[model samples]
Target: MATYTINVNGKKREVDADPDTPLLWVLRDHLGLVGTKYGCGVASCGACTIHLDGSAVRSCSVPVGAIENQKITSIEGLSEKGDHPVQLAWKEHDVPQCGYCQAGQIMSASALLKKNANPTDDEIMGAMAGNICRCGTYNRINAAIKTAVKNS
Candidate 1:
């Protein structure tokens, strides 16, 4: 087993496991941070998306060792009281259908808003393309993003 030191949700965390273990497992199984879900083991599904150094990344394919010293932010870290603009907008727009992919969707949306405070509809779609919402809440997701942008 290898020991890895990483910064998660603004706190230093250390875990002992195989270096090649996917970060999603480490975050959920080891660290008890179940906010990041596992839909597909591969990177095709964005259910495991998280922020690595403020960039959206698929945690399912990310090795535990790869994020050493990197700032990792999960859905839980998005806001202190779950009152981030994106979260609020999501609530106001009722974006979640099944709610399985909302965490990843929110992560990607937050990243996009961080980069482009005023993103066009096309830009929102492009940034969120990788994240799949099986509940088919795309319309509400887009509206939530736009609402978040307006409030931000």
Candidate 2:
């Protein structure tokens, strides 16, 4: 194992792990940042999503070593009080059934809004396609994105 330092949620964090250890494991195991959930253990599911350099990334597929010195943002760092517009919109819309995928879903939506303040429905769907909500709350997810935009 090697020691690597990375910027997470604006703070410098150091972890000792194997170079191939996925960012998801590093965040959960080493950093104790469990908000970024583990699912599928691959890049297909968005459950391990996090912001890498301001863009949504699948932490499960990213190695901690590859991200050294890069900025990382987990769900916990999205806002100090969990009051980000997208978060508020998620709550306002009551968007989650099992709630396991919401963090990644929110992260993706937040990233999308950061790029396009007023994204079209197609854009929203296209951006969120990678995130899978087993509860099938796609309609609510879409509504929350629009609400988050309006509330922005």
Best by lDDT: 2
TM-score of 1: 0.98
Estimated TM-score per prediction?
0.98, 0.98
The CA lDDT at 9 in model 1 is 94
Candidate lDDT (C-alpha), each = 0.93, 0.94
- Model 2, TM vs. native: 0.98
List model 2 lDDT by residue over 53-100, tens digit each: 899999999998799567999999999999999999999989999999
Candidate 1: give the clashing pairs. Answer: none
Candidate 1 lDDT, 95-135, residue by residue in tens = 98889899999999999999999999899989999999898
> Looking at candidate 1, what is the lDDT of residue 11?
91
Where model 1 places Cα greater than 4 Å from the true spot, the runs are none
